[model samples]
Target: MRLLRLPEVMYLTALSRSNLYRKIQAGTFPAAARTGSNSVAWVEEEVLAWIQARIDERGLPDTP
Candidate 1:
């Protein structure tokens, strides 16, 4: 149930700040939880699952 800060999320996802926000806006990425008025963090498990999903997608075979 750990929450990851923006920097940590960026590092783990290898996404720039702008791109991350863009994905979030597009509903393609996990949403962050508001920790404070000026602070937000993502759930660690959600981020990890997103990464794993990407990996799984990449490992799938292409179909005609």
Candidate 2:
């Protein structure tokens, strides 16, 4: 039930911020939960799941 901030998401997904935002806009990724007026975070499990899906689709190696 952990939550990840932007840097965690970027590191975990190997995505640039703009790419991440693009995927969000395309409905291809999970939206972050709003934590405050200027804060948001993604569920860790969901981020992991999304990474898994990408790996599965691209036949990429697992993250260490």
- For all candidates in order, the CA lDDT equals 0.95, 0.94
TM-score of each: 0.90, 0.87
Model 1 / residue 54 / CA error / Å: 0.5
lDDT of 1: 0.95
lDDT score at residue 5, model 2, on the 0-100 scale: 99
Best by lDDT: 1
Clashes found in each candidate (C-alpha, N, C closer than 3 A): 0, 0
lDDT of 2 by residue, 1-64 (tens): 8999999999999999999999999999999999999999999999999988877998767789
